[model samples]
Target: MAKHGFKAIEALDITYVLPTYARARVAFVKGKGARLQDTQGRDYIDFGSGIGVASLGHSHKALQKALKKSAKTLIHTSNLYYIEPQAKLAARLVEYYKRGDEGKPNTQKSDKSKWRVFFGNSGAEANECAIKIARKYGQKDGRYKIITLDSSFHGRTIATLKATGQDKFHKHFAPFPDGFVRAKDLSDIPNKLDSETAAVFIELVQGEGGINALDKKQVQHLAKILKKQNILLMVDEVQSGIYRSGEIFASKVYGIEPDVITMAKGLAGGVPIGACMTRLIDVFESGDHGSTFGGNFLSTNAGLAVLKTLEKMRKDRTLESTTKYFHTKLDSVLERYPAVFSKRVGLGLMCGLQVRSEEIFSQILSACLRHRVLVLRSGGNVLRFLPPLTITKSEIDEGFTRLLCALKELKISQTQKTAQKSKNPK
Candidate 1:
C-alpha cells in the first residue's frame, strides 16, 4: 500500500457509498484474533470487536474452516427444502436455552417440543419475527400493542424503528407503524398496559442506550407480572448474547426466562445471522412467516461453528475467567481515573465507563484512536467496551495500557486548552 492508500479508499467510499456511518479515519486490511492491521501496517488491539459482531475475533480458524467447507458444499438453496446446518444450529441454540432454563431455580421448566427457532439475516429481522409472533398470539383477544422501555433500541426497519423507544430514532420517519408505546420506567409498565397490550420488549442490558443494565429485581418482578397477565415477554439479546455478557444470554444473568428471545450480532462470529427463539410454538402457523435466505447453509454453518466454539469455552470456563479478568482491569482503570471516568456500567464484557462529559468522551475516543486502540461510544457520554469473548488477559493489559496513555494525552491537551482560554478571555 502507498502512503496515501487510506485517503484514496476514503475518497472512493465518499464517492460511491452512502454517508450513513461516521467511519474512523483508518482502513484496516487484515486481522488475526484480537488484533487488526491497517493499510499502513499498524496493528490495533480490537476492543470494540466490530461493535460486538466479531465474537470469535478476526480470522478464527474454526469459523474459517466452517465457512470454507460450507462454501464448497453449498451456500444457498433458498428455504424451500430442508437445510441440515440450519436445523443443527437451531437445535444447538435450543439446547443452550434449555440448559439455561433448567439451571435457574424456581423457573418454569422448558418444554423442548414447545420451543422453536426462526432464522433471519439481522437483529431487526429477528425482532420483526418476534413482533409477528406476539401479534399473532394476541389476535384472538384483539391485543396488538407492544410496550417498550425508555432508552431502548430495537432496529431501523419501519416496524422495529417504531418499536425503539428512543425519540431520536423516531425522527425523520413520519407516521410509523402503530401499536407500539414506550414506558417511562419499569413501574410505569402496568399503567401503560391495557387489554390491547400484547407483549413487553426489553434489552436486559441496554447496549446503545449507554450500556445500562436493568435492575434485576425489577426485571424479575416484571416477568412475573407479565406471566400472570398472560402477556408475552420478549428479550432483545442482539448485542448482549453469545457470551458477550459472560452468559449465553443476558436474560440468564438476570435470572428470568423470556417468552421470546431475539439474538444476532455475534451469533455467527462475523457472518450475518439472526435468530428468534420462542416458547410459544403455535403462534405462527404454516405460511405465516418465511425468509428467503434465512436458513441458508453458509450462515447456519458459520453459526454452528461459533456455537461449537462457545460451547467449548463454556465447558472449560474460558468465558468466565476472561470476563472476570477484563472487569478487574476495567475497575483498576476506573479507580485510577476517577476524575475522568465517573463510574463503570453494564455487566461482564459488555461494559462501559461513564465519562465526565460528552466533550471529554469525544476527546478520549479520538485520543484512543490515535493510540490505535479501537473502542465504541454509547449514549450518556459512555466509552463502551464490547471486546471479543476470546480476548486474553494479555490483550486486555495491552488495550488498557494504550487507553491510559490516551487519557493522559487528553488531560494534557485539555489543560493546555484551558490555559489558552484563560489567557484570551474577553
Candidate 2:
C-alpha cells in the first residue's frame, strides 16, 4: 500500500523514523527521466536528482533490466567467496580510472603499485576504509592524524562527522574521535602539517560546501608538498566523480594523481555502491578489514550497467553537450538576476548560484516547490543544481524558467515588504 498524503501524517507513525532530516511534506510516488510525481500526482522537474544519486534519471530501462536479470539469476552470495559481477565491475572501474592516465611518466613507486578497488555500501563506508588504510600504513611511524578542510563535508558517520571540519555539524556530537586535525584556514594548512600527519583528505568539488571547486594550481601545489612528505593525498569524489565534471574524475581535470580516491554517488546508477581505490592497494593485508554486503552480485551488476551506459553516452558526447548548454543557460540566469544571486560557481552539471540572503533563499525554495520545480540548497546560501546527466536541453530550459519565476516572486515579495516598512517609519 502507498503512503497517505500529508493530511494523514498525524494518524501515521511517521515519528517512528528518526528525525534526522527536515523532509518535505509531499511524498514522491513515481519518477521518470528527470521528472517526479508525488502521491497527489503533482509533477515536478527534478533538478536535485536525489542529491546526485539517480545518475541515469528515474526508472531508467537499462538499470531496471540489469537489476531484474540479476535478481532472477543471483541476487547475492557471501563476500566469503568471489563473485563474477564484483570482479568484472572492479576491473572496469580500474580501467576507467586509467582512461587518460596513459603515456604519463611511470617513475614513481605509486605508478608501479597501480590502483585497486575496495567496495563498500556508501560513501561514508568507503571513506572509513580509507581512514583505516591510512592509519594502517602510517602506524609504524606514529602518524595517525587525518586532515580535512574547513567548510567541507565527508559524511554523516561519527568519525566522518569529526572529519567534516564544519562546526555546525559538530554541534551536540561532543567528544569526537581523536587524531583528526581540522584546517579552518586554508592558507595555514601547510603550517599545520607535521610528521604525525597520515593523510590529507579533500574533495575536488565540495558538493555540500556551496558547490565549491578549488583552483587547480593551488591543489596541484598542495599535492606536490604532500608527496614530498609522504602524506597520502586522498580525494572524496562521492559527488563529483563519474563524468559529472566533464571528466571521469574531477582530479583528472587538475591533472593530479591522488594516492586514494573514494567514489559512490553515481557509481551504480541508483544502487547503493561505494568504492575507494588506492595506489597502495596492498596497504590493508588480509584479516585487517572487511564488509559482508560490500560487493554483492546485484549492486556490482548495476555498476556494470551504469558504466556501459556511460560509455555509450560518452561516444555520442551527450553529457558534455548538455552540460555546456546548461552552463550557457546559467550565465543567462546570472545576467538576469545579479541582485538576487551574487555569482555562479562549479563546472559541468554540478552548479551553484550564490544566493544573496538566507531569507531570500527560503522564499525562493518555497516558490520553486509551489511551482513544481525541485532544487536544493548548499552551504546555507547556494542554490545547488545537480540535474541528471541525461536531462534534455528542453528540460533544462523549462527548469531554469521555473527557477527564475521563483526568484522573481521572491524579489517582488521583498520589494513590497520594503515599501510597506518604508511608509510605516518605525
Full-model lDDT for every candidate:
0.88, 0.84
Identify the leading candidate in terms of lDDT.
Answer: 1
Which residue segments of model 2 deviate by more than 4 Å? 1-3, 9-13, 101-113, 412-426
TM-score between model 1 and native: 0.94
Q: Which ten residues in a row have the lowest lDDT in candidate 2?
A: 101-110
Summed backbone clashes in each candidate are 0, 0
Local lDDT at 255 for model 2: 88
Worst 10 residues of 1 by lDDT: 100-109
TM-score versus the correct structure, for each prediction: 0.94, 0.93
Angstrom error at residue 408, model 2: 2.2
Candidate 2: RMSD to truth: 4.1
On the 0 to 100 scale, the lDDT of residue 245 in model 1 is 81
Tens-place lDDT digits, model 2, residues 1-426 = 146675576335464766677877777888989999987888789999999888888999989999999989998887889899999988887777676544233444447247888999999998998888889988989999999999899998998889897899899988888999988645557987998999999988899899999888889999999999999999999999887887778888888989999999898888999998888877888888888889898899998988888767866788888988988888787766665677898877889899877878889889999888899999899999999888988888888888878776875456745654554444
Candidate 1 clashes: the total is 0
